[model samples]
Target: MTGGTPGPPWSWVWGAPGPPRATRRRGGGRGERPAGHSRPTPPASGPAHPPPLYQAAGRWGTPRAAVRVGLLCRFAPPQLPAWPTAMATVVAQRLSHLLPSWRQAHQEPQPSGQPEPVFTVDRTQVPPLFWKPYVYAGYRPLHQTWRFYFRTLFQQHNEAVNVWTHLLAALALLLRLAIFVRSVDFWGDPHALPLFLIVLASFTYLSLSALAHLLQAKSEFWHYNFFFLDYVGVAVYQFGSALAHFYYAIEPAWHAQVQTVFLPLAAFLAWLSCTGSCYNKYIQKPGLLGRTCQEVPSALAYALDISPVVHRILVSPDPTTDDPALLYHKCQVVFFLLAAAFFSAFVPERWFPGSCHIFGQGHQVFHVFLVLCTLAQLEAVALDFEARRPIYEPLHTRWPHNFSGLFLLTVGSSVLTAFLLSQLVRRKLDQKTQ
Candidate 1:
């Protein structure tokens, strides 16, 4: 080709006419280039003219346009370099790995078909009926099933200690009764009957208290009902204590002064304690008035029930004798007083609200002290019964029907009171919902 004349546009194509083949001129034949001619420089590395499609794509301005060019380049001739197709394949593989995580990050989570976990909440999160004074946190949600409340007996919560203390106490009382029965003729001897009643009452109250604390979170209706029954148990215990004290612990002189009216008054006072407690809870009364209404009758009943023992203690001989019965009586009195103080004062819990939520509350302390008191009281009464058995067995010829009858009547009346009060509470709740 001459410089003055243009070569064909297809000159850049491989195998097209161009310079003489070097292999053909092995022996210097006609295949050799003319002496004046120089082999035309091979066209600069790539095709001399790119396809019009690439030219139209220009500088590949945007990422989307670049992707389109790459897709188009994928179908081009094998001689054309396919850098865009390789880049697109690499990008698609990277996106395949990332797409799931990106979708997961943006999508809402789905439920797993299991119940949501129950957690303890603050006082404000619970219903008003579940609230306690100075207790700010660790209230379980209300309206949970009975199984949930039973399960919570092992869980950490404000009521866990309360339920456990009374439950253990009830078991302890049962063990004590079993041991005591081995020594005394509980069924045959009238003198042992009063102590038997006391043991029975102790077991009743402790078991009822444990059940009350464990299951009361079911609802407002159940809360009132369980605690009302708890009050009845307390009343039964008080009357039982009174019977034991009057029969065994009372001095001759003190018994002479109060014998005519003592049992009757004690029975009345026991029923009164139950009535006051049930009424206080039924009204849902708050503050000092409610506290007084609940506390006063119980205090009076305790004062009456314990009077005979106090008289005997004060009038008895010297303390240096190391009398086991007297020592147990003293411990009983001390523990009862401590229990009363904790019950009324709400001590450490009042000082530090949420800090003692799962443990160490005043009510829990009261339960411990009360259990101790009952244990001491039982030991003292059992000793008193053995010591006075000979004296009482000969003097009292008749079966002491009066003592047992009054206790039974008191228990029946308290149960009736609690039942009536629970019905009233249900009616009030119904009215409120309406």
Candidate 2:
């Protein structure tokens, strides 16, 4: 009466009471027994044992009500079946573990407080299709901002190796720089500008690549900015290479004659490469024109820069005087081409998506090739410097700011211009979304 209708008379089978003897005798049969029967008691009533949970239903309420309360409270008596109780506990524990992560990923923020750290989330929880494909489940570490890069360093994400590879390369180049300055007259020597430029370019290339990889998961805005900066770094590095070749390989007379033409051309190409990259990423289709625009200028710069060295290699008939740098130069070209191919085709991963998410991906391979290419270039430059030492003139003495100034001006102008254009395109994109 307190909760609901009574349970069945025989519910006492699991150690609870049944109908009274007089009541059963008077009724004369099971079919004659009425509803709302009081549960059975112990014959002597000294103290009846607590009933099994299933049998206790008549005492508290109906069988259905007691079962509902038992499940909700997780208070199933010792007599309840073991397997069902264990299953319920497991379900509850699983929900408890998963709910917090779900809330962190999905819930809106409190306006009155400081921002919470952006934790990594799975693909389903991320903004739909926000990242590149083949990244797979664990590889996608979404919502991690720049502030969390330290934490992300230890996390097992796809970009982890790509970021660290370039970072280590940058550190190696720094050590190489220290050794280089100690070995040569870095500041005092006039011809050291090209060497300085080479070091700077190497540092820029690695640092930009690492930063781009690090910041890519931050947000779309940061992603585009860092990606463009990385592209600019590539252009600047190629131009720096060209400067090293021009300074060492060309005569001062020829340089004087061609400075007007070469400087403008280099600047144009740098700007073209950067601008084209930004356009390729944002606007253009990933077709032939877009690919050509992105790759051609840097490829052209490498071809031209290495041409003079290649010419020298061919012209020198003495096998003994053959430059080791020339062999490395050839290796560098092969590595560069390999890197480009891996980047465009997304090889290995394209063959088996998600399998290589944490390691051995195309981007990681690209970074490795880039590092090798830079090392090869450094070796060649060092060798060229040694070869030209006897005839090396302090050309910077003649002009206070010549190739160094022009090179800096050229790169700066191009980068700034490309950045502004990218900003414009990004603005348009944002407006459309709004």
Candidate 3:
């Protein structure tokens, strides 16, 4: 009213104290018109601006900021002055630019159905001595679950090479056996006893070694059992090697002495290896060498067992003078030593972490050298068998094709011994843990 507001009088308005309710007119409804009264017509166009309460106070004449704020804050408490609506509009425009950027910075739009990447962990997650470089995740023990280990066969990790190398070696040994059977009357020979045993032992070692490599990392328990089997394979192979060496070199009189000492000693060591593996794995002693230390005694035993054979070769009237074969035998020994060094030292990977993880790690190198060593030993054995060509004197044994009975006896006894020792160690460890 102070600013001379322009509108129809309030008395004629609908909700004010105006006309009586029964006399109110309805637009276009049937009704009687009073004398000299004309019907009102609607406006052709709407009002140019909104009502004063809703309009910007400044109407964009100068800076409309004050007007916009006043409009925006008109309903604020009487104690507070209203802010300019133009200022609010300017602030809103500025915020509009920042909102998109803020969203992009903090909330990226990912694909609808994409899966999260698989996570890999660190070496601290695995067993202490068994920790391998380049292996990131999935280091569960064997008893936990089958999926984890089975997945490891397909996944890229440190043990990949170790497992595959021995597996390929097993296949190669099988091929070599097939070729050897084709070339010689392996079953018909009187001296086939030792050769057959050597082949069987060699095959067993390769196969077991491969299997252990594949499955040993599953858990400490699995590690102990498979490593025990591997140790037994080593002992059997070593025994067969010494037997063949002595069979060709030692006389019939000394045979009893060789068998008495070497066979019993080999069996004992094999048993020791089994229990040692169990102790190291279940006990988890910091300094104990569960799988690797077993090889030391075997190495010493092999050296002692072969001493007589070496002496016989040196003193023989017509020693093997074949140059290539001799060189191969020497190479075989050197490679075996190299394999032992790699197994003990964990080379290449040890010296340069992550460098040879996928392909040339120490364990894989050891497997390769083992295959070469076996090939060289086979060559040397064949040459020695040829050099000492005895008359065809068949033995009174039943297994004419192979030493099947002996093979079964040796492997079965070794497995049973290892199992008993493992069970004993497991029970003790469980008690301690409890």
Instruction: Give the winner by lDDT.
Output: 1
Q: Give TM per candidate.
A: 0.72, 0.66, 0.60
Sorted on lDDT, best first, the list reads 1, 2, 3
How do the candidates rank by TM-score, highest first?
1, 2, 3
Cα lDDT tens digits, model 3, 215-319, are 776666677778778867776776676656655545444454554455555545544554455455555654546545555565666675565555554545544
Score residue 398 of candidate 3 by CA lDDT. 30
Clashing pairs in 2: 17-40, 18-40
> Tell me, what's the RMSD of every candidate?
14.9, 12.7, 15.0
lDDT (tens digit, per residue) of candidate 1 on 1-434: 23332232223233234334342223122354465564444334434444465557857664345435644654567536545676799999999989998997887564578455485888888888898777888888887777778889888989998999889989988888889878889778667788889999999999999999998888889999999999999999999999888888877788768777888999999999999999999887778889888999999999999998899789878744745688888899999999999998888988987678787789999999999999899988988887866545553455434888898899999999999998898899899999
Q: Once superposed on the true structure, which residue ranges of model 1 sit more than 4 Å away at CA?
A: 1-112, 394-401
- Superposed by TM-score, candidate 2 places the C-alpha of residue 183 at a distance from the truth, in angstroms, of 1.8
Can you give the lDDT of residue 104 in candidate 2?
A: 78
Local lDDT at 362 for model 2: 86
**What Cα-based lDDT does every candidate model obtain?**
0.80, 0.68, 0.59
Error of 1 at 233 (Å): 0.5
Higher-TM-score candidate among 1 and 2?
Answer: 1
List candidate 3 segments past 4 Å from native.
Answer: 1-121, 127-129, 132-148, 249-260, 274-278, 286-296, 316-324, 354-356, 391-409, 428-434
